[model samples]
Structures are given as C-alpha cells and as structure tokens.
Target: AQSVTQLDSQVPVFEEAPVELRCNYSSSVSVYLFWYVQYPNQGLQLLLKYLSGSTLVKGINGFEAEFNKSQTSFHLRKPSVHISDTAEYFCAVKGDTGNQFYFGTGTSLTVIP
Candidate 1:
C-alpha cells in the first residue's frame, strides 16, 4: 500500500511571489509521483510526474518538484506565481502498474494580488 501526506492544508501568497507545497509518501514498492492542480469546480489536471531519471521534475504553470528518496519527499515549488494560480493542489502516488492513485487531502494555494 502507498500513502501520501501533505504537510500544509493551505498556503497563501502574493502574486508573482514564490510558493512551495510540501508532500511526503511511503510505499513498499517503486511508484510514480504526481502533482495535480484543480481549478474552481474543475477536475484535477496532471502537473507533472517522476517516472524515472532525474530527481528534479518540472510541470505546468511554472511548477516543479524534486524527488527525494532519502527523505521520501516530493515538494512542489515555483519561483513566481499568479493570482490565476489560485487553486487546490494534490500529491499522489501510483504503483508500478500505475493503476490506483493515492492522494493527499489537498493544499489550497491562495494567490492574492
């Protein structure tokens, strides 16, 4: 089984400022890491994935995350943000087969201008 923990439930920031959303996971086997963003009353969209190779992975909306095996963390970060970036973010883990997905409760990013 796999599980994810998002350290913060809400993060507020100013427009064009930097932001980071923390995430941690535990699994018995190799898995895929993903970050999804959900807009108001909308479905989640894939931000990025760490399938293999580099530990640092980039995604949409100027967001990026680095996979840390030792710490079991995949923290999302962006140097600058926009008010439009205001939304909910979720961190998820999928097994090798990439079938079932386990997600964190969610982190709401409120970008104020």
Candidate 2:
C-alpha cells in the first residue's frame, strides 16, 4: 500500500517570495507521484507528475518538484508566488497496479502581499 504525508497543514508566504511544500510517501513497490492544486471553491487541478525518467519534473505556474526515491519524498517548489496562488495543495500517490490513489491531508497556501 502507498500513502502520502504532508508535513504542513498550512503554509503562509509573502507575495513574490519562494515557497516549498513538503510531501512524503511510503510504498513497498514503485509508484507514481503527483501534486494537485485546488483554488477556492474549485476542484483540484494537476500540478505535476513523476511517471518515469527524469527525477526533476516541471509543472504549470513556474512550479517544479524533484522525486527522491531514496527519501520517498516529492516536494513542490515555486520561485515566486502570487496572491492568486493561494489554495489548497495535495500530494497523491498511485500504485502501479491498482487505480486507487492515496492523498495527503492537504496544505493550504496563503499568500500575503
């Protein structure tokens, strides 16, 4: 079984500053990792994913994450953030066999200007 853990429940950052949202997972077998962002009153949107090949994967809105298999971590990072970036981010992992996906509790990003 695969599970995800988000270290922070909320992350507050100043506008135009860099921010990193931590995520960790555990699984006996290889799995796919993903990051999703949900704006206020909206559904989740796929931020990025690590299927294979590159350890570093880039996503929308100048965001990127490095997959560390040894550490079992996939942390999301953005160079600079804006007020509009304020939302709840979730880290999820899906096993190679089943369609089931495990998700984290979620980290709320509040950007202050």
Candidate 3:
C-alpha cells in the first residue's frame, strides 16, 4: 500500500514570490508521484507527475517537482506566483499494480496581493 502526507495545511505568499509545497509518501513497491490543484469550486487538475527516469519533472502552470527516492518526497515548487495561483494542492501516489491512488489531505495556497 502507498500513502501520502502533506505537512502544511495552508501556505500564504505574496504575489510574484516563490512557493514550495511539501509532500511525502511511503510505499512498499515502486510508485508514481503526482501533484494536482483545484481552483475554487472546480475539479482537480493535474499539476505534475514523476513516473520514470529523471528525478526532476515539470508540469503546467510553471510548476515543477523533484522526486527524492531517499527521502520519499515529491515536493512541488513555483519560482514566482500570481494571485491566480491561489488554490488547493494535493499530493498523490499510485502503485504499479493498481489504478487506485492515495492522496494527501491537501494544502491551500493563498497568494496575497
């Protein structure tokens, strides 16, 4: 089984500032890591993912994450943020065997103007 943990429940940042959301996971077998974002009253959208090869992966909306096998972490980051970036972020993991995915609680990002 695989599980994900997001240490921060909320993150507040000024516009144009950088932000990083922490995510950790545990799994007995190899897994795929993912980051998803949800806007107010909207469905979740894929932000990034780490499937194979390259430790670093980039996704839409200027977001990127690094897969650290040693730390069991896949943290998402943005060099600069905008007010439109305010949303809830979730970290998820899926094992190689099944279609089921384990997701972290979530982190709400508020971009302050």
TM-score per candidate = 0.95, 0.97, 0.97
- The segments of candidate 3 whose C-alpha lies over 4 angstroms from its true place after superposition are none
Question: Clashes per prediction?
Answer: 0, 0, 0
Q: Give the per-residue lDDT of model 1 (tens digit) for 22-93.
A: 999997467789999999999999999999899999998799999998889999999999999999999999
lDDT per residue, candidate 3, 1-113, as tens digits?
78799999999999999999999998746899999999999999999999999999999999999999889999999999999999999999999997999999999999999
* Whole-model lDDT per candidate: 0.94, 0.95, 0.96
Model 3: lDDT of residue 38: 99
Whole-structure CA lDDT of model 1: 0.94
Cα lDDT of model 2 by residue, 3-26, tens digit: 799999999999999999999998
Query: How displaced is residue 13 in candidate 3, in Å?
Result: 0.6
Work out candidate 2's RMSD over C-alphas: 0.7
Q: How far off is residue 84 in model 3, in Å? A: 0.4
Model 2 segments more than 4 A misplaced: none
Clashes counted in candidate 1 amount to 0
lDDT of the structure predicted as candidate 2: 0.95
